[model samples]
Target: MILKKIIEMKKVLVINSSARTLRSHSRKLTEVFVNHWKTTHNNSHITFRDLGTENVPHINENWIAAAFKPETERTGEEKEALKISDIYISELHQADIIVLGTPMYNWSIPSVLKAYIDQVVRVNQTWKLNPENLKNPYIGLLENKTLFVLLSRGAEGYGKGEYNEHMNFQSDYLKTVFNIMGVHNIHVVAIDGTSFDPEILKQTIQNSHQNVKSLIEKELA
Candidate 1:
C-alpha cells in the first residue's frame, strides 16, 4: 500500500504601513511576495494587518502600566487598556513567518508602524529584562521565526557602505527591534530612488520584485 505524505500549513502575518494605496511601492513588493508565497504554500494561512488605514493607537500611560503589571494581577481597566496590544502580540506569537512592508519617512519607519511596534514590544510578553547581564538586558520571548522587511525609499544610497548609509535609520532599526524579539532570520529587500526618472524607477521596482521572488524561493526551499 502507498501512503501520501502530509504537509503542515504555515501561518503568515503580513503587515503593511504605506499610506498610499495605489502608488505605494512598498505595498507592491508585499503583493508580489504574498502572491508568490501563495503559489508555493497554497494551504498556508495568511493574516494581514494594514496600519496605513487602521488606527493603531500609540502607547500611553495606561498601556505602560498595564503591560508592566503581572498578567494575573491585571485589573479590568488594565486589561481593557492593553486590549489592542494583546491582539497585536497574539498575532506575533501565532505567526510562523512575518512580512512587513513600509516606506521610509524621514529616514525611519512610518509613524503608524512605529505605533504598532510600540504595541507589540511588551514587557514579560515579547521580552524580559535580564538583570544578570547589564550589557544585554533584553531576553526575547518569540523564537524561531522568519521575517521579511520590504522597504521603499524616495532617494538612493541608503544601503550598507553607500553614500547615504549614515542617514539611514530604517533597515537597521527594524532589524534591531525584531532581533530583540528573537527573530534572527530576517531578510530585507529595498526599492530605492523612487524620486528618480520614471523609467529608472520602474526598473528599480522590477529589480526589487525579482529580489523578493528569489528570497521566497530560497527560504521555502
Candidate 2:
C-alpha cells in the first residue's frame, strides 16, 4: 500500500484588529477558525497579533526615506523608523497562511487594519516597481500564500449581489491590498447584522462556522 503525505499549513499569522476587545464578533469568529484549524492540523502554529493593543504606528517621512534608500545605505535613524515595518513584513513573508479578525466600520475595514496594511505593503520589500512596464507595472515577490478574513458587520446586505452590495468595501479593499502584495488566495467569512437581534447574532455565528469549515475543507482538499 502506498502512503499519501498529508499537506498541512505550518505557520499562521492572526491579526486581530478589533478596537473593542470584549464582545467582538470578529474575534469570536476568528477563535472558531483557529480551533477548527487546530483539530485538522494539530502541529500548526498561530502567531496572534492584537492590533487593538499593540497598534503599529503610521508611516512618516523618516520611514519613507528609509524604505526608498538602498538597504545597505540606510542610516541608524532611518532604520529605526522602519523597525516595526520590517518586523511586520518579515512575519508576513514567513507565514504560510494569514487570518484577519476585522469588524466592518463605516462600510469598510477598521482604521487599525488599514494602518497595518499600509505598514507592510512596501515598495522594494514586498513588491518590485518598474514604471516602464505600463501593462504590468507593479511586480509582487511574495507568492503561494493564503489569507482568511473573519469579518463582523453591524447591518446586513453587504456582500456582492446583495441589496447594499455597492457599500461593501471591507472584503473588496482587502482583496485589492493583498493582491498587490502577491497573495491572491483570499477567503472571507462574515457574520452580518449581529447587532440586529439576539437570534440573528446566534444564527450568524452558526452560519459562519459552517462557512469556515467548508472553506477549510475546500482549501485543504
Q: Which candidate is the best by TM-score?
A: 1
**Runs with alpha carbons beyond 4 Å of true place in candidate 1:** 1-8
Q: Rate the local accuracy (lDDT) of all candidates.
A: 0.90, 0.86
- What TM-score would you give candidate 2 relative to the actual structure? 0.93
User: What's each prediction's clash count?
Assistant: 0, 0
The alpha-carbon root-mean-square deviation between model 2 and the true structure, to one decimal in Å, is: 1.9
Candidate 2: 10-residue stretch with minimal lDDT: 1-10
Give one digit per residue, the lDDT tens place, for model 1 in 1-221.
Answer: 11111122768999999998899999999999999888877577899999999999998887888888788888888888899988999999999889999999999999999999999998888998999999999999988789999999999999989999999999999999998998999999999999888899889988999999999888755
Model 2, stretches more than 4 Å misplaced? 1-6
* TM-score of candidate 1 versus the correct structure, residues matched by position: 0.95
Model 2, 1-221: lDDT tens digits are 11112445468888899999899999987888888888778567789889977857998888888889898999898999999998889989999888988999998888887888889889978898889999878877678888998899999998889998899988888888888889899998999998799887898889998998888778776
How much does each candidate deviate from the true structure in C-alpha RMSD?
A: 2.2, 1.9
